[model samples]
Target: MVEKKFTIESSQGLHARPASVLVNHVTNFEGDVMVHYNGQSINLKSIMGIMGLAISQGAEIKVTAEGEKEEEIMESLEDVLKEQELVKN
Candidate 1:
């Protein structure tokens, strides 16, 4: 299992565009990937699940992955977050 925390830094927060990008990115991985925020956890590959959270700027979120490629998945997710400018430096 691998886990990492990040603070949302995008002015628009984790809105539709970034949320779609995130979901699309994780869908390629084999295993379970989840995002936790505001005491709730949801599958990272579900666009509705992520957007439903209404995660705004400054919200701290925890991402976790478990399975054979957990580490790689986490690294990929971190890169996506940074590339999208959705996480703080």
Candidate 2:
């Protein structure tokens, strides 16, 4: 498993658009990805699960990937987060 922690930077937090971007990106990978926030963990591929978290700006989140191409998935996710301007610099 590969895990990384990030602080959200978006003013609107992990709202629908960003959540969908994340879910859509990870869906292409053949691995398991999960997001942990506020002591709860949810599948990163599930838009509803992410939305249910109601993550706000500056919230700390931990993402974990396991199985095939876990490391690559982590790197890709980091890239996506950065590209989306969702994480602090």
Candidate 3:
């Protein structure tokens, strides 16, 4: 398993757009990916689960992935998150 933390930088936080992006991104991986927030962890690939988190600006989240190509998925996720300006530097 691989885990990494990220600070949300989007002014709107993890709203529809960002959440959708995250959901779509996670779907590409063949691993189990979860997002931890507010002491709860949810399936990152589930749009409902992610949107339910209601992540706000500056909120911190930890993403963990286990199973096939976990490392590559994490790295790609990092890149996509950065490109979306959703993950703080």
- How does residue 84 of candidate 1 score in lDDT? 95
Model 2 residue pairs with clashes: none
Please provide, for model 2 over 1-89, each residue's C-alpha lDDT reduced to its tens digit, 9 standing for 90 to 100: 99999999999998899889999999999989999999999999999999999999999999999987999999999999988889855
lDDT of 3: 0.90
> Which sections of candidate 2 miss by over 4 Å?
none
RMSD of each: 0.8, 0.7, 1.0
**Which window of ten consecutive residues has the lowest lDDT sum in model 3?**
80-89
Compared with the true structure, all predictions reach lDDT values of 0.94, 0.94, 0.90
Models ranked on lDDT: 2, 1, 3
Pairs in clash, predicted candidate 3: none
Q: What pairs collide in candidate 1?
A: none
Better of 2 and 3 by TM-score: 2
Off by over 4 Å in 1: none
lDDT of 2 at 43: 98
